[model samples]
Target: MNAQTVLASSGDEFKAPGPELFEFPPLFAGGPEWLTKPVVFAVFGSLVVVVFFWSAFANPKLVPRGVQNLGEVGYMFVRDQIGRPFLGKNTDQWMPLLMSVFFLIWIWNIFAVVPIIQFPIASHIAFPAVLAASVYFIKIYLGIKHQGPVKYFTNMIPSGLPLPVYFLLVPIEYLSTFILAPFTHAVRLFANMFAGHTILAFFSLVGFWFLFEKPTVAGFSVGIIGVLVTIVMTAFELLIQFLQAFLFTMLAAMYIQSGLHAEH
Candidate 1:
C-alpha cells in the first residue's frame, strides 16, 4: 500500500523513522536520472570547497583577513594534525590533496544537520568506497614504485618468523593489507554517517510525530524528550562528522606513508 493508505489505516498513530527515511526519491522524479538531491549536494559540496579556498586565497593578504584566516586555520589543522604526523617531510606536497579530502568529507557530513539539506552525503556507501579505492590504488602504486613489486610483498608479511609460520601469517597479512584495509576504510566512514543520520532522523521524527502531528497531553512529555534528544544528538553528530572526516584523511595519509616505507 502507498504512504497515504498506510498512514490513514492507523488512527492517531506515530511512524518512527527507518531505512525509508534515507531513501530520497529523485528530485526530478520524471526528468534526468542523474539529477537527485544527493548528487546535487555532492556536486554543490565540491564546488563549495573549491570556491571557498579560491575566495580565501584569491587575494594575498600579508597578515590574513576573513576567509583567508579561516582557510589558513583549516590548512594548518590538516597539515599539523593529519599530514605531518603521517607523512612527515612530504606533508607540504600532499597538503592540497589532504586538505581537499578533509574538507570535502567534512562538508558532506555536516550537511546532515543543515536545515533543508538534512542528509549526509557520506551516508551513501559509494561516496566512501570511491575515496577508499583511490587511496588503495595510490598505496599499491607507491609501494611498487618505492620498493620493487617482489620486495613490496615480502615486506608486507612480517619477517623473523619461523618459515612454517608463513603458511598462516602471510595470507593473513596479505588479505589485511590488500583487501580488508580498503574495505574497512570505506565502511568506517559510511557506517558512521549512515548511523548518525538515522539517529537524528529518528529523534526528529519522534518530536514531529508526537508534538506536531498527533499531540496529546500524555504524549507531550514524550515529544519534549524527543526534541531534547534530537538537540543533543545533533551536537554529538557534529563532533562525529568532524572526527570521521579527520579519520578518513588520516588513514589515507597513513596508507600512503606505509607504501613509501616498507614495514620490517
Candidate 2:
C-alpha cells in the first residue's frame, strides 16, 4: 500500500507530503506527546537487533542452521569486512559494538520500507546524532586512554611541518577531527534516509493520486509511469539502505582504529 495516500483530501485536490510526514503526534489521544512513533520504533529496532542475535548465538551449535546460520553470516561479515581490516587484533573485542551498530541501522532503514510502519528511525537527526556522539566520545576516550592525554591531542597535529604552517593547519585538523567528524557522520545517514523516504512517498503518492483517486485520460499514463518508477526506486532504495548501514558501521570501526593508533 502507498504511504502517501492523500496529503489533504479537501475537495479532491492533491497535496504533497512534506516534513509533516516525518513528524507524528502521540499514538493515542492524551498520551505523552514525546511518545511518538519513531521513539517506539527506535526502541523496537534495538530489541529486534538484540533478539535476533541472542536467539542465534545463545545456543551452541557444532553446525550452524536457521537463524544461527544467518546470524553467523552477518556476524562474520562485520567481523571480517568491517572489524578485521581496520581493527586487526582488536576485531573480536569490538565485534559486539560493531555488530550492534550495523544490524541496528540496517533494521532501522528496513522499517522505512515496511508495510504500515514506514518511518525510518534514522531519518531524524536526533537518532543518528546520538549514535555518532557515542562514537565520538568513545573515540576521544580511547585516544586518551591509549595515548596519554597530552599526546592524544598533540598527535592530532602532525610533526615535521614548517612552524608557520602549524598555525593554520592545526586548528583545521583539530576541528575536522573533533567537531565536524561527528556532525558529518550523523548528517550523512540522516540526509540519505530522509531524502530517500521522501522520494519514495512522493512517487507512491503520485501513483495513487493519479491512478485511483483522480483517474483521467492523461493521468492514467502518468500514473503507470509513477508506479514503474516506484518499483525501480524501491529496489534502489533497498540497496541504499543496506549500503548506508554498512558505511556507517565501517566508519565507526575506522574511528575506533584511529583512536587505538594515533598515527591513523
Candidate 3:
C-alpha cells in the first residue's frame, strides 16, 4: 500500500511528533537563562580563538614549529596576501585588525556546522551588521585622520567631473560607498548564512518527515532521497561558510584600502 494509506491505517499508533530539530525553549518562559546552546557556542568559539592564538604566539621559534607555524601562516596569509596588497606600507599597523576580523569570521562560520550548534551567529543580521559598522567607522576615522576633514569629503567625490555632474555624482558616490556599502557587506554575509541554514533545516526536516511521519515502503523510498539531498547540502554549506568568511574579510580590507588611498 502507499505511504499515505499506511499512515492513515496506522493512525495515532504511528503519529508521534518527530524529535525537535533546532529549537531551544526558553527556560521559565521569561527567565534570563544563562546557559543556552548559543551562549555555549559563542563561548566555545572565543576559547578556541584564545587558545589557538596563545599557542601560536606563546613561544615563538625561529624555524616556526607547532601552533606557531599555523599561526604564522594564517597571519601572513591575511597580512601579506590581503592587507599588504591593499594598505601597502601601512599594512603592519593594521595586522591586528585584519587578524581579528579573519579569525573571528572564520570561527563563526565554521561553528555553523558544529553539530550541536548548527545555527550560525553571523546568520543573525545584528552580528554581521555590527562588525560591518565597526569597519565603516574605522574607515571614516582613518580617512579623516590621514586626509583631514575638508579633503576627506572632497576625496570621496570623484575628480574630473563636470560641475553639473558633481551634484548628481556626489550624492550617488556618498550613498553608495559611505552609507550603503556597510549595510550591503553585513547583509551579504547574513543573508548567505541565513539562507544556507534555512535550506539545511528544510531538507533535514523533510528527511525526518519521510523517515518517520510517513513510515512505509514508498515513504522510505522518498525519505532516502531527502537524506541524500541533505548530505549534499551539508557539504555545500561547508564551502559557503568558508567563502562567506573570506569574502567578508577581503571586502573589509578593500574598504580600508579605499579609505587609505581615497586621495589617489
Candidate 4:
C-alpha cells in the first residue's frame, strides 16, 4: 500500500487509495508546507505518553492500582524484555530512553486505529528517521568514547577470521553495522505503519461507498466482504503495532549495549 497522490479522475469508477491518502491538506491556504496532520499527530502522541506516565507514577503509592498497575506492567516489560536482555546490569541507566521510545512509538501506532486522530506518526518517515538517527549517533559516540576510535572499528572484526578474509569482511561489516542498520531500522517501522494504514483506508472506503454511497443487491455482498476484511485487518494491525514498538526499542537497546562493549 502506497499513499501519495491527488485524485486521478472524478469518474464513478472506484479509485483505490494510495500515497495520496497519506497527504494532508493545509490548515489554511499558503500555510507552511511542513504544517500537516502528521506533525500534529506526532506532537500529540508525545504529549499523550508524557501525560500518561505522569498520571501513573507522579505520587507515591503503597499498593499500585489502576493506571499505576498498568504502568508497572509496561515498565517491567520494557526492562525485562527489551533493556535487560541487551544491557543487563546497565538497564536502569537507559530505562528513561527505552521507556520513552517504547511508549511513544506504541501510542503513535495505536493512533492509526484511534478515532478523530487516525494516523500513525511514524508512517510519515521523518519521525522514525529522527529517532533512528539519534540512536545511530549515540551508538557511534558511545563506541568511540568507551572503546577509543581505532578500537571501535577494530573490535568489530571477529577473532577467528583469517588474514585474507579481513579484506572482504571490513567493508561488509561497516556497511551493515553503520550504514544499512539505521536505514533499515527507520524504514521497517515506517513501511509497516504506512502499508497498514493504506490497507485499512482502502477497505473502509470500499465498504462505505458500496453500502452507503451507492447501494445495490450485487454490491451489498461486496460491501460486507470489505467490512469483514477491515475488521480482520484491524485486529491484526493492533498486534503488529505493539510488535513494531517492541522491536524498535529492542534494537535500540541492542545498539546501545554494543556501543558500550566490543563485538568480539
Candidate 5:
C-alpha cells in the first residue's frame, strides 16, 4: 500500500519527517523565543566538549588514568588522522584548534542519537556555515599575515600557467579558493547530518507506526523491517558523524596550512 493509504489506515496518521523535524518550539512559556531545542542542544554540546576535555586533562599523571587515557586516545586520533598529516611539523601548534573542532562537531552530531537530545545541531545549516566562515576568515588572516595580502591572492594563481592563460585560470582559482571552498565546506557537513537524521527519523517513525500505533497481519512484517532498518541506519549514522567531524577538522587544517605556505 502507498504511504498515504497506510498512514490513513493506521489510526494515528504518520507525519513524514522533514525540515519540520528540525524546527522546535520554545522549551517553556516565557522563555526567550530563540531558546528552542536545537539552540539549547548546541549550547549544551559545546559545554559537554569543554567539560569532558577539562576533566580528562585536569590532573597531571605520570601514566594516564581514567578519563585521561580515553582523552589521550582521542587526541592522538585527531593528531594523526587530521593535524599531523595536513599541518606537518606545525601540527602541535594547531592541536588545540583542531581538537576543539573535532570534538565539538562530533558531540554536536552525536546528539542525534542521544536519548532526550535527539537533534543534530549541525543539521541546522547556520551552525556549520558559521564555523566554515570562521575558518575562511582565519585562512585569509593567516595568509595576509604571513604572505601579505597582495602576495596572497597573487600566489593563489598557479605559477606555471602561460601569461595569456591568466585570462582563464585566475578567475577559476579565485572562485574556487575564495568562494566555493567555504560554501561547500559548510554544506557538506550540514547536508550529511541533515540527511542522516531525517533518514533515521523516517525509519523510526515507520517502526513506531506499524508495530505499536497500528498492528496488523500485513503491516507486522513491514514493521519488523522498519525496526531492522532503523537499527542499521543508527549504526551507520554514528560512523558518518565521526567521519564528518574528522573531515571538517582535516579541511580546516589544510586551509590553515595552505595559508602558511604558498602552493607551487
Candidate 6:
C-alpha cells in the first residue's frame, strides 16, 4: 500500500496519546524503532560539531581570526565562568569534557531550525541519558581518585547532621544525587526539546492542513492563525534551544563542582 493509505489504516498505531504532540510514524517520529530520525540527526550533529571545532582551532593564529575567535570566546566562557570556579586546581583536566558537553548540546539544539534537517537530537531520551551517565561516571571517578572508596561515600553525606537524621538524609541524598539525578537531568533536556519540537510540528502541520484540506473562508482564516502561532512557537523554540544548552552545561559543571567539594 501507499504511504497515506498505510497511515490511514493504522489509525490506532499512529495516534498520539494524551499530550504527546507527535505520534510514531513517518520514520522521523520519536519511537523505539531501529532507525529513527533523531538518532540519525544525532550522528550527523556530532560530525558537524567535530568538523566545525577542528576547522576553527586546527591552525591557530596568534592574532585572532574569524571562526577561531568566536570559538575561543565560547571556550573562554565555559572555562572562566563554569569550569574554573568549580574545578579550581583541576580545571584544566576537566575542561575537555565540559567543552564537549556544551558544544554537542548547542549544536544538537540549533539543528531544530536549519532547513532540511529539522529535528533536535537532544529531544531523544537516549542521547541525553548517555551524556548524563558520562558526567556521573566522571564524578564518581573523581570522588574515588581524590578520596578512597570508603571515604567517598562517607564524604558524600554531611557530617554535622544528627545520627537519626543521617539515617533518613543519607539514603535520600544518595538516591537523589546518585541514582535519580542523572536520569532526571537527561530527561529534563530531552523532555523540553521533545515537547517544544512537538508543539512546533503540531502548529505547522495544522496550518498546512487547514490551508489544503478544506480551502474555505473560515479555513483560510484558521490557517493564517495556525501559521502565526507556528512562527511564534518557532521563535520561542530558538530561545529554548540556547537556554537548554546553557542550562545543561551549567548543571554539568555544577555536578562536577559538587563532586569536587564533596569533602567540604
Backbone clash pairs in model 4 (N, Cα, C under 3 Å; residues 3+ apart or in different chains), count: 8
lDDT of 5 at 93: 93
lDDT score of residue 215 within candidate 3: 65
lDDT of 1 by residue, 126-211 (tens): 88999999998989999999999999989888778899999999889889988999999999999999999999888888778768
lDDT per residue (tens digit) for residues 5-120 in model 5: 66667666667788888888899998898888888889998998899889899884879998888899999999998888899999999999999999999999999999999889
List the candidates' TM-scores in order: 0.93, 0.94, 0.85, 0.93, 0.94, 0.84
Who wins the lDDT comparison?
Answer: 5
lDDT of 6 by residue, 101-208 (tens): 888998999888788878787877888999999988877887787677788888878788788998899889889878898988898899999988888887777677
Instruction: Extract clashing residue pairs from model 6.
Output: none
Rate residue 116 of model 3 by lDDT. 69
List candidate 5 segments past 4 Å from native.
Answer: 1-13
Model 4 / residue 231 / CA error / Å: 0.7
lDDT of each: 0.89, 0.90, 0.79, 0.89, 0.90, 0.78
Deviation (Å) of 137 in candidate 3: 0.5
RMSD (Cα, Å) of model 2: 3.8
Model 1: residues with Cα > 4 Å off, grouped in runs: 1-11, 32-34
TM-score of 3: 0.85
Count of clashing pairs, candidate 2: 0
Quote the RMSD, in angstroms, for model 1: 4.0
Model 2, position 237, has a per-residue lDDT of: 95
Please give the clash total of every predicted structure, in order. Answer: 0, 0, 0, 8, 0, 0
Candidate 3 global Cα RMSD: 3.9
